[model samples]
Target: MQSGKFKTFYLPLAAIAAIIAGLALSFAWAAGLLGHRTTTRTFLGDSLQHFEPGYRRAHGKGICFTGVFRSSGAAASLSKARFFSQQEFPVIGRFSIGAGDPHAADTSTTTVSMALLLTADDKSQWRMKLNNAPYFPTRNAEGFLAQRSAFEPDPATGQPDPVRVAAFFKEYPEARKAVEYKATASSPSSFAGAQYNVINAFVLLAADGKRQPVRWSMRPRTTLGSLSAGDRAKASRDFLFDDIKQRLAIAPLYWDLTLQLAEAGDPIDDPSQPWPEERKQVIAGTLAVTGVHDQAAGGCRDINFDPTLVPPGIELSNDPVLAARAGIYAHSYNARLREIGLGKATEAVGHGDSH
Candidate 1:
């Protein structure tokens, strides 16, 4: 009788234990903590997480984003070179902040950003990550990468030591600007008022094979929709992920992707020089975020948005950073792909549809 009673309880307990073990295994797989998969997942997570503190440092609060895609009714009049046009393809937009690591709270006051992109014939996407503001304080991508790597914590302490940051900032001018920007920005409201810029450094090619330098801008539909001070203080680190998930759940986040085409003889290389608003030709296009891709589920993590994936009509115009990014992004993507057993990635539209 005692054996029968013990068996009854033990069987249920054993079953429960098995279920729990299975769940833990699933979580491990999802987190990419299993074997070689861990490397790829960790790299992607590190890249995204790298932005968190920078977002808080810049925005003074946290981060939030909305992504929208083009609706079918709208006409895509974006010009193209060669036989391909920018209008023919559909796009996916990923809006984020220039700062804020994956671990930091998304509600931090970093600059709001968006990447509007379209799928090319080759299955590669052509996307441009843009900020709400008009200029990037960093001198170049290499400089940006160096500062970011340094800003991360010292492995020994696992804490962000001010002394280390100070030493890094001593060499990086942009880090100095960041320090100054944060020193004075005491309140979230003060930081919210800070104008963010998406430094334009890419060239758009027209149907005539002419290259026009471009800067893109997207102003909020309503300035009243900004986060409150309380929101910042109470927000979770995943505020951006949550905010975007909620917004995309209800109404689509809408933004105008305005292109300011540069005139002839304008310098194409230097992004520091702002094109006069009057001289900037605006080609207005609507960006609608239909859905938020899951970062945890390999949506945002598995891919690299290489700007070289230009559609037919859009061409690269000797932008040094763009050229460098093309190679770097390609290598990184391939590395992650190889580690994850994902195989090689396809190239963007260029030749025939052999991709």
Candidate 2:
């Protein structure tokens, strides 16, 4: 009788204990056991972790410069931001290739990029991230990761496996637009001549609290120019730097900041879907690139061109990739900081050959 009583009570308790233990294990496994962003359903941290090896924790590689941002006060009508006024502030800028690797080749690389950090007297700042390409490789962070995984180089070949890349395109057909665009746009001859775009959309607010979804770009005052294959083949590794340095000696470069208003049916949330060319465009301001500098000691070397760092009158959109960029960049930055503390890095992060 006593044995039966003990057996019934203990058996039930043991079963309950097993269930609780299993649940605890499951929770732990789900938290991080799957791996970083690639394997698990997580946020920016995980997605950014995958890029550490490929990018060397630099996020994006470029050369830094310093200049002046001249405002026509025209953008104030579009958005009442202080920088859009007639005020002139010191500008820190960067010129880069698309790859994240700091040491990537300069001469033959096709994707050109520019970053501007417009700072005010009170330390408030506006950052504009512009790329030469009109379209990005992937639409969102999910597509970005899928593209990265597919583009992983074969260890022996040291190049992307064409089969995997083809399969990736099959799976995510949206990436084809970017692939085609890049195919047509070889690297331009000089940074001063190529147009740069703020492909991501933002809501610019007038002082009256009305907001408008808008996209913006900077068109070079100089006519757009591209290099021929022969020029690229015969160029030195530091050709871009040499050219820009020589170019700056002649005159300050210029680009007009053109902001486009989104019409009805235009996709404001999806940066991958560009607005039609016929959309209403306004010349918000002018960007005068007065000078250039080396990344090692320039203002842009240490700064992140935060997408959401707008003043009071500008608001960020609900674009997922744009949202994730801030966090991902923070993660990349902290990782690099830790790596640098451990003596794995030098002070020059986005330094070019000229540095």
Candidate 3:
């Protein structure tokens, strides 16, 4: 009788435990914890027809730079970050075009970018990935993925189908603003003349526990110049990189770090929208590009420049895109490091094979 009772109780309990384990495995698969996670590979596959192993999946064409950031003491009231103090911090930065292929021609794309990593004396680091665009094309990662899919090249024509592109803009009307901006905007004559904006907003925590929302831009001190038709015709495949290197050889390039303070009713989470021009602005500091080096030399080449990696006085805002970028960048960094370890690294354009 005791054996019969034990069998009845324990059998039911064993079946219940088995059902729970099965449900957990199912949930893990659905949540992407065990399979099919969206990553940098997903977006890159949608954007590019080919993959360049051992290199960044996006903005692969770049030049590394080292510099110094001299804080002006003007931004001390905004945040307690050491870089805001009146001192100099070492900086590693990269300048690149918005292309998936590292060997893409300089004139192939008008979009340019700057990624910066500033190291304070305390060893804390502030990293930023900025672009010349006034605002991002999509508000969130899903929207961006859809946008890339919509513009993906058709195998037969080697260009995006207008019907698909139109459908995408119809569904996501906000993206039209960025497309319009790109249509009317002129490409910078040189990288030194381009202004790079941190599209996402971040919070500055002061010593008094006060918080402020702000977006910043590196406003090049070099006067903006237009690219002449003759100059464009004569441009080499690496004109922009060559031009920056030649310019740096003569003197250091400089940009004033300008911050735009957000007021009431401003959108802190959406990077697709821009703040009003009349908002309060502050000159935080100056960034001086003291030297330029080949990517193969290993300066800023391996750095991910994840924007979410902020120092102690700074905090990430509720921007969904910012949060998504952290994961995507981490995956790209790790994947490329593995490739390098396996000796699968390839040479970047104009730079010899990475070692």
TM-score of each: 0.58, 0.79, 0.87
Cα RMSD, each candidate: 17.3, 7.0, 4.2
What digit string (tens of lDDT, one per residue) describes model 2 on residues 1-355?
9999989999899999999999987766544342333433444444334343212343255667777877777778778788777577888888887665565567546778888888877777888778877866666777777887777789989999999999889877878998788667776888888888888889989888778899888889998567888987887766777778888888888888888899877877787888899998888777788777776556565677777778777889888777766655655555565665565555454333333
Q: Hey, what RMSD does candidate 1 come out at?
A: 17.3
- The whole-model C-alpha lDDT of candidate 2 against the native structure comes to 0.73
Stretches > 4 Å off in candidate 3: 1-36, 39-41, 48-50, 153-159, 347-355
Give the per-residue Cα lDDT of candidate 3 at 336.
Answer: 78
Candidate 2 lDDT score at position 47:
39
Clashes of 1: 32
Candidates ranked by TM-score: 3, 2, 1
lDDT of 3 at 74: 91
Candidate order, lDDT descending: 3, 2, 1
- Candidate 1 per-residue lDDT, tens place, 77-177, comes to 43453213333445654445445343334544445655555665566556665555444435454545555566688788887777867777676555465
Root-mean-square deviation of candidate 2? 7.0
Candidates 1 and 2 compared: the better one by lDDT is 2
**In order, what lDDT does every prediction score?**
0.50, 0.73, 0.85
- Residue-by-residue lDDT tens digits, candidate 3, 217-317: 99999996867768777788888998898999999999999999999899999999999999999999999998888886747877889999999999999
